[model samples]
Target: MNLAVIPARGGSKRIPGKNIREFAGKPLIAYSIEVAMRSGLFEKVIVSTDSQNIADVALQYGADVPFIRPVELADDYTGTRPVTNHAIEYCRQHFFEPQLCCCIYATAPFLQVDSLLEGYQELHRQQDKAFAFSVTSYAFPIQRSLRKINNGVEPVFPDNIAKRSQDLEETYHDAGQFYWGRSNDYLSSKKIFSDHSIPVVLPRHLVQDIDTEEDWLRAELMYQAYMRDHN
Candidate 1:
């Protein structure tokens, strides 16, 4: 069996009720739930949420709310590790044990089903890897990036200032969408982006971390652009 666990807490400080907030149309979390369901990749799509309202929204969209996440794990300080670990343990005790597990984030409205399948297949194809997660290359070279010095900007890598952009190596970042790994690997490791993991690179436009109001607007705009281009 395979499991997909989405962690969503109600105490969102940046954007109130961000998880259930309407995105392009449905709730933000609804996108993740829908993709997980449509992907046909998991035996169960479970949402680990502290808020009953969020749980209701999750169930409304066909995700299982087997257990209300503990208050301790739902706090602002808590990260994905503990919340996911709790969900895995709960499933083991009450339901069938999952051989493979995927941690799908609640705010990932831009997640795609095809890419998710790729992760599952790729993880198995590469047995040496412990996990497979979404990632996207930076639009620009990071070596040529700048940083805030006391009063003005300074090149992060002074040596790269003279190097051609084309000559620089490309860097990718976590798309913050989904993570697939063996059940034991997830339960044992604190970090997912290790040498043991493989990256599933996604188009940069489909990758947005919507943590602030500005980010929400950007994501919406990106979504619109994506639809227009794809449609």
Candidate 2:
């Protein structure tokens, strides 16, 4: 069975009511719920949240709220793995246990159904890998990165200062959208971005981390652009 677990806690310190907060035209979580539903990959699309409001929105968007997340697990310090594990445990008891689990982030407005489907296909294609996640190449070479100290700037890797960008290998960063993995690996707390994980590369324009008011605005603009061109 395939399950899509959306971990949207209510206690968002950065953006108030972030999970249910309106984005463009609907709740932010709605985009994730909709995309997961539209992808048609998951047997069950479940939202694991500590907020009744989020649950209601999830249900309205055609997702199931099997359980309200525990308070301790809903805290700020709680990481993604534990929240995902909690959802997996709930499924084991009340519903169908998932063989493949995909954790979709509520704040990820840029999530595309194709990407989720690609992750699923890639996971099965590379049987040796434990996880397949959304990723995008870094805009710049990390080897040529700079660090600011006082009023001066220093090279992070001074040795690579003179290396050409084309000569340097490309590195990718997590797109922070979704992760598809074996349910057993998730239950065992396997690292989401470890060596066992495979990358599902997405275009940079379709990736953004919605952490602040500015990010939300930027995402809206990008999403609008996406709608005009792709939708």
lDDT by residue for model 2 (166-191), tens = 99999999899999989999877568
Candidate 1: list runs displaced more than 4 Å. Answer: none
Which 10-residue window of candidate 1 scores lowest in summed lDDT? 187-196
At residue 15, candidate 2 shows an lDDT of 91
lDDT for each residue of candidate 1 in 1-231, tens digit (9 for 90 to 100): 999999999999999999999998889999999999999999999999989999999999999999888888978899987888888889899998988899999999889999999999999899888899999999989999999989999998999988998999989999999999888888885468789888999998789999999999999999988888999
lDDT of each: 0.92, 0.92
Candidate 1 lDDT for residue 107: 92
For candidate 1, the lDDT comes to 0.92
